[model samples]
Target: MISLEEFKRSFKVALWFMFLTFPLLVIKVNPIERTVLWKWENMAFVGIGAFILSVLIRAFFIQKERSRNSSKNKRRFGYIGDEPLVQFILREPKYLYPLSGGVLIFALLFPALFDTYQTNIMTTALMYVVLGLGLNIVVGLAGLLDLGYVAFYLVGAYSYALLNYHFDIGFWMALPIGAMLAALFGIVLGFPVLRLRGDYLAIVTLGFGEIIRLVMENWNAFSHGPSGISNIPRPGFFGMDLSLDSAILYIYYLVVALVIITIFVVNRLQDSRLGRAWIALREDEIACQAMGIDKTKTKLTAFALGATWAGLVGVIFAAKTTFINPASFTFLESAIILSIVVLGGMGSILGVIFGALVLILLPEYLRVFSEYRMLAFGGILVVMMVFRPQGLIANVRRTYQFKKSTKGGDS
Candidate 1:
């Protein structure tokens, strides 16, 4: 509590923080009133706040880092995941099933409980959850780090939109075709780059995404030259069209069903033979090949499967918005999806739901800081990488500890 060394270190950190926050705190603009305010006092206040936060953070992290190397702490803590909250849930499916069921029950009754706006937000969150899960297959499960994943989304949306626009195809018919087209695109894109890894792979994928976007942007005949296809068919059962509230609720229920299906499918894959092959490739591609996992087949499957979900989500997005344009699908979209996969524990389904809820809904919560939302998100990603790269709710492996008897039992 009375360490001078700590104070010096904290003071240095505060100075750096002040340097970082100076621009943000020193300038304030009022768009409503059309006025600008300059206050040096605000900077001082932020500096003081930063100093305190730095001190506390330093203390906690330093102690934790030190404790990580301590055998006594390890013995005492055992597994941090074994704490009361998730201990029972992670260990036993008997408990996990009930918890999941309760959540499902609440989700089913959510629209009745909440207003339309909240329902829309929840639906948006579910869409993101699905997107995150889709990318999770490529980046999380396969460890591929795809930055062009949104290209598949665009392919799906356009496939559905163009099909419906010209042929008068309905949502149900367009959905499968859209998804299949997206998967085909995935396979086509995955073919050439099977050998690349890490940054090179990322750059190629980014280029692929940009190329697709540019094609959509410039192709005047096909995509209407960025005017986009409007009046897209709305979702309906039979010939009866739903009202606004009913439509939102319908989409909400529909996405909820899709999210469940996605979760089920992904969960099964993660536990199956192909899933094991993916993990082996992720761990060591050379070794995986030696062990008989086909690189081209596995990689293409990953891309195709991952793209399938993105395509499905794209179909839903088109129905929900009823408009399509090149601007809608961009590299930023891919970044956000990748952010969800990384911010959530990689390869964890529940973690993805949590990540989607946080990232997608956070802007709504921070509406005042709407412009700064991306800035804040980037900062959080940076801080998380620095402090806890594994993620907030990292998937933990179960370990069986065998304790040997210290003394022999007497006969």
Candidate 2:
């Protein structure tokens, strides 16, 4: 129920939006003809849209406040894990299993249903899924903020590009080599930041990423300068010659397989001994170390393992595009990967997967809105942060309860 005051507020918001968007949305200039055209209808559209949105947003906030107050008085509150819809489904195995099966089936058949362009977009999204999961290990579970994760990504990409260009190493051979090289670089990065935490650690990682990019950009002979490396080959299937379409399909399936493997490993890691150490370290480094967890080894392992996935995807990215450039692995790329992890529930695999799809595919589909796409993107992100900062799904920890035996004997 919107009162007079709410309506007045909404009107004010609408007027502000109209003013802000007037030059861009409601006016056009023909510089060659020296004429200016004003589309008054656009102003009306903006005003109405903004008014409705503002009203709905305010209503939501009101309801949320009421709910928060009520929840405070409730003895047992709802478990705030997955988003409401996701939680509703996941709370029941009957719903969860069927949904998971349906999704897997859809993924397997996606290439068959869509064209190469769509398949390519999905491949890119899946690549980010792996990257997000990788960074999740460091930033999410391990609670180590890494702003330069793309350094390892750069290493993996350049490793394959350089190796293939000079040594004629194929994609298959370069995959493991790229991964190991990235791990080595991760260790190199880890050793220096062993004592740093929070903002200081983030700064070091950011500097490390910049350093890698600078070296790649300036080293003309080694990295081909700004021109970048081209003609990188895609992954092959048993030395078989495949058509462009066949190759695209093959890569799609390959990434799907990789995503599956990654999810499996990450899920298992969440329940393993090392995973607990990482979680404890995330909560409190001082307490975790005091409890006999080796801080040095834990941090190093987080960096190394997290980077391995980036390396893996980096190789695939180089192969997919058949081109490698320093510009492709910028700080922006790292930020986007981090955003995916953050937008998804930090330590949740399913959340990362969904976040990757939403973030990557949404932009591609919004090409029709070209000029306004980023505007919409930023608005959506702002709303998400304000409303649900925990992400699409919150990472839920496994809990156990002890039950006493009937006779008071140990059970």
Clash number for each model: 0, 0
| Cα lDDT computed for each candidate against the true fold | 0.87, 0.90
Q: Using alpha carbons, what is the TM-score of model 1?
A: 0.86
Candidate 1 C-alpha lDDT tens digits along 1-411:
336788788888778877888778877889999998987897788778878987888788777876666564354343554253455476678989899999999999999999999999999899999999999999988989899999999998898889988998888888898889989999998998899988998999999999999999999899886889998877887878988889899999999999999999998898788988888888899999999889999999999999999999999889888999999999999999999989988988878888999999988778999998888999999998998797767765434555576555422
lDDT of 1 at 158: 90
Deviation in angstroms for 305 in model 1?
0.2
Estimate, for each residue in 95-134, the C-alpha lDDT of model 2 and write its tens digit: 9989988988999999889899999999999999999999
- The Cα error of candidate 2 at residue 255, in Å, is 0.2
Q: What TM-score, to 2 decimals, does candidate 2 have?
A: 0.86
Q: Which stretches of candidate 1 lie over 4 Å from their true place?
A: 1-43, 62-88, 397-411
